[model samples]
Target: MFWQWLTAPWQYEFMVRAILLSVVVGLVCGALSCYMVLRGWALMGDAISHAVLPGVILAHVLNLPLALGAFVFGVGSVLTIGFVESQTRIKEDTVIGIVFTGFFALGLVLLSKVKSTIDLTHILFGNVLGISNTDIYQTVISSVVTLTILFLRQRDFLLFCFDPTHARSIGINTNLFHYLLLSLLSLTAVAGLQAVGIILVVAMLITPGATAYLLTDRFDRMLGLAMGLGAAAAIVGNYVSFYLDVATGGCIVLVQTLLFGLAVFFAPKHGILARKFWAKIDL
Candidate 1:
């Protein structure tokens, strides 16, 4: 009975596809999340994820690929925010809030008009189990492109994220890297849409990286650990969801959140209780 329960979810093709897609999305989001964490761009991820909604709707209505529409709007949102921040005294976060909310609201209006063809629930919350072959292929492509860029540009991007002035002094084009990272962010969010939807994508993009940051100081190790945590969460979350009949994306995010909570109290150097314990020992 134990063995059967463990192997049960793989008996169907849908489960296999769902699990594969989830793993890919988890890995890609986790890797990029390290940079997002370091750069204080958590809100940016949320902004892009929500801002893609209208693009997805527009794509469906125009019979274009969903990813294409999502990518366009995601980039558009970033550009708009940048333009706003550059032209005024407003803060980046404030600009992001205003822009994303407007795009998401527009998406909602577009969604209402096309309710018959598009499912708002699925777009907002995702349907991993209902993933199609086309989605799998697109996810695979997105993962490849995202991972490749991250690997090749890791050092340069890290410099930019940590200290943009230093990166500029070192002859790196801060503007170029900034936009490049945003492009990757947009792609990853679009890819993640199939597994976790817009709402949970922010969690996926932030939680794993935050958890890994608490546990490690080394950036490479942080990336590896975050990816592992995310992939494990997705797999376990899917299995638990299958048995309990709950929402897959929510379950996955729940597991990531739990892991983060654990890190908060137990991580060696950064955790709250760990610091207290170390101080006591020092005394």
Candidate 2:
């Protein structure tokens, strides 16, 4: 039975597409997340993921490509957050709260308007059971763009993340780089949203990076570790989805969560377990 399905899985283009999309999104987000964690923007990633939903629905309503709408709304939301924070004397967290809630509410309203005609469930939760070749191509393109952004700005991003004061002193366009990084993050989130849904999509963006932090302190090491963990989760989640009939994206997130838990318990100096042991031995 296993052999039969394995032999025939690619006979269905949708299955192939689903697998391809999952891997591409995972890889792209994993790489981008290294910068996110160091910049203290993990929660921002979560917010950005949720922010893209309205754009997606608006596009769906207008019969446009979801990615196009997602990028527009996603970038718009990031700017709005900046505008709100600067215009009001509010804390950044408060601004983030306002932006995600307001934008997500807008998405829900838009989805409700077309809920009868469209399978809105797939929009929120994703219908990754099948995908199109177009989606596969788009995913690959997005992955490349994400990588290119990271490569072109790696030094600036790293300096901003590790020591923004020094980065600014060195004449980096710290503010421009900051906003541009957030914009890139939103773009990555939008790319993954259509494939993985918001919850898992955001979770993947944050989780692998968090896990990598637990495993390593060096920037490049963390990036490598995050990518490896993400790819591993995708493979395991795919198997779990295929054999156990679970949600693929959620299952992948679950794998990340478990890995994170383990990292917390058993990783090096920063790990809870390791820190405790060191204190006890010294005492």
Candidate 3:
């Protein structure tokens, strides 16, 4: 019975697709997350994830590709936040909160005005099992593009995140990388939508990276660890969800969260227990 249960998720084509999608989304989100964590952009990830909602609704109305609408709004939200921060005395966090909430509310209002053809639950929470061939293709393309750009420009992005002024001093176009990172964030969010939807996508973007951060001091190791954790979480979460009959996306997020908790308390060098142990030794 245990062996059968282990093999269950693989017996179906939908499961195969879900597993593939989960890996793709996990890898992209996990890799990008290291940068987000280092740059203190966790809230920014949340902002883009929620801000894409209005574009999703608009796309549904116009019968356009959901990815297109989502990408536009995601980028729009980042730009709006940037403009607001530059023009006012308000902090970046405040600007992000305002813009993202306003955009989210607008999406809700638009959703209400339209007929009930759209599945609000699916849009908000996602239905990974219901993924179509087109979604798979789009996700694959988006993942490839996003990952390729990130890998190729890793040095520039790292410099930009750690010290934008220094990057500018060195003649790197900091502004370009700034907007490029935002664009990639949007792209990754859209790719994640089909797996976990807008709500849980932020977790995927932040948790793996944060967990990896706890585990390692090096950025390259952080990236590798995050991706491995993400992929493992997705696989285990999907398998568990299949037997438990729970929401697949939520299960994946839950697994990632659990892993993060474990890392926090048990990581060899940086965990809470480790720090306390070292403190006791010093005394």
Ten contiguous residues with the weakest lDDT in model 1: 131-140
Tens-digit per-residue lDDT, 1-283, candidate 1: 9999999999988888888889999999999989999999999999999999999899889987777898899999999998999999999889999999999999999999999988888888988999777778877898899999999999999999988999999788999999989989988898888788888999999999999999999999999999998899999899989999999999999999999999999998999999999999999
Give the C-alpha lDDT of model 1.
Answer: 0.92
Best by lDDT: 1
In Å, residue 66's CA in model 2 sits off its true spot by 2.8
lDDT by residue for model 3 (1-283), tens: 9898778788999999998899989999999999999999999999999999999889878987777888899999998998999999999999999999999999988988884877778878887899878778888998999999999999999999999999999899998998888888888888887788889999999999999999999889999999999889999989888988899999999999999999999999999999999999999
The sequence of per-residue lDDT tens digits that candidate 2 reaches over residues 106-134 is: 98888888788667667666667765566
Error of 3 at 119 (Å): 0.7
Candidate 3 local Cα displacement, residue 248, angstroms: 0.9
Candidate 3 regions off by >4 Å?
A: none
TM-score of each: 0.97, 0.90, 0.96
lDDT of 3 at 41: 91
Clashes of each: 0, 0, 0
lDDT of model 3, residue 14: 95
Residue 151 Cα positional deviation in candidate 1, in Å, after optimal superposition? 0.5
Clashes of 3: 0
Clashes by residue pair, model 2 = none
**Which portions of model 2 show Cα errors greater than 4 Å?**
1-13
